[model samples]
Target: MIDKKQWQAEQAQFNDTSRYNDIMDKPRHVSHAHLPMTGRDRAGQFAPFAALTGYHELLNKIAQRYVNKKYPTGAEEQAIFDFFHQLPTGDAVRLELTYFNGESGYYEHYRGTLDHVNWAQQVAYFADGPQIPLRNIRVVNRKGNAHGQG
Candidate 1:
């Protein structure tokens, strides 16, 4: 069973008044290498591991809403990726991610931390896999505009 109340709370927090929307929905882009450069000048630039907050909660939500109903496969990833891809490069949603990445089931509740937000640059493309790993999560600085400052 899922923590219905807690999930609702977290969703509320994620959608709270935050510029997360601006960041998640950007139209510009930049690409980083997914491979490594162990011994060269590019030595620490190509790490592939990604860190996503609320890892489990996010996964579970997506699974239930998008994956659990059917076979979780490469195509599933493509679907998720495509969904994100179509999101006008300028409308990212900042959802609250849980701490411990969902290590404790009860920890699934939102802790009210803005630790990070994904700009949703571009959804990762996985040709074949069990599930699509949330990849290319660019940290958004949310540059301010003319009228008001960030």
Candidate 2:
């Protein structure tokens, strides 16, 4: 290992800020009016560029897996219909809903209180503000009740 004094002395030359200080103190030849770029424009010139355009978006799309809407079987349909018929008036019953989200083109499962069941429109409105079509529903689970119990 080199001696501490010798090592510090060698480093002292590189640590000198005199050259940089002199360059900064020197007046620039270009006038403010003649300057081609503003601060924002100058910063944008050094901004990072995407090597592969849309690569991140493509990766995100691939990473995001979605489930397709599942059609209910005959027995499941019957049970769901029965559960809806037995619901007490104005009562908020907890329900697990599996329905299609058109915006995402995926089937998402949600658990919330059933606010209204529109038989004529064939839609079930949840308390959390999702109006799910009866045909789009894959599964219906009544909270705190077993299958065919509620």
| Candidate 2 positional error at 4, Å | 83
Give the worst 10-residue stretch by lDDT in candidate 2.
141-150
Model 1: what TM-score? 0.21
Q: Which residue runs of candidate 2 sit more than 4 Å off their true CA positions?
A: 1-67, 146-150
lDDT of 2: 0.73
TM-score of each: 0.21, 0.46
lDDT of 1 at 97: 22
Q: Which segments of model 1 are wrong by more than 4 Å? A: 1-71, 92-102, 105-150
Write the residue-wise lDDT of candidate 2 on 1-150 in tens digits: 357998899889788787798588777687677757789888787666645667777666654533454556788777777778888978778887666675576877788888898999988998889888776666667665644221
Question: lDDT for each of the candidates?
Answer: 0.37, 0.73
lDDT (C-alpha) at residue 41 in model 2: 88
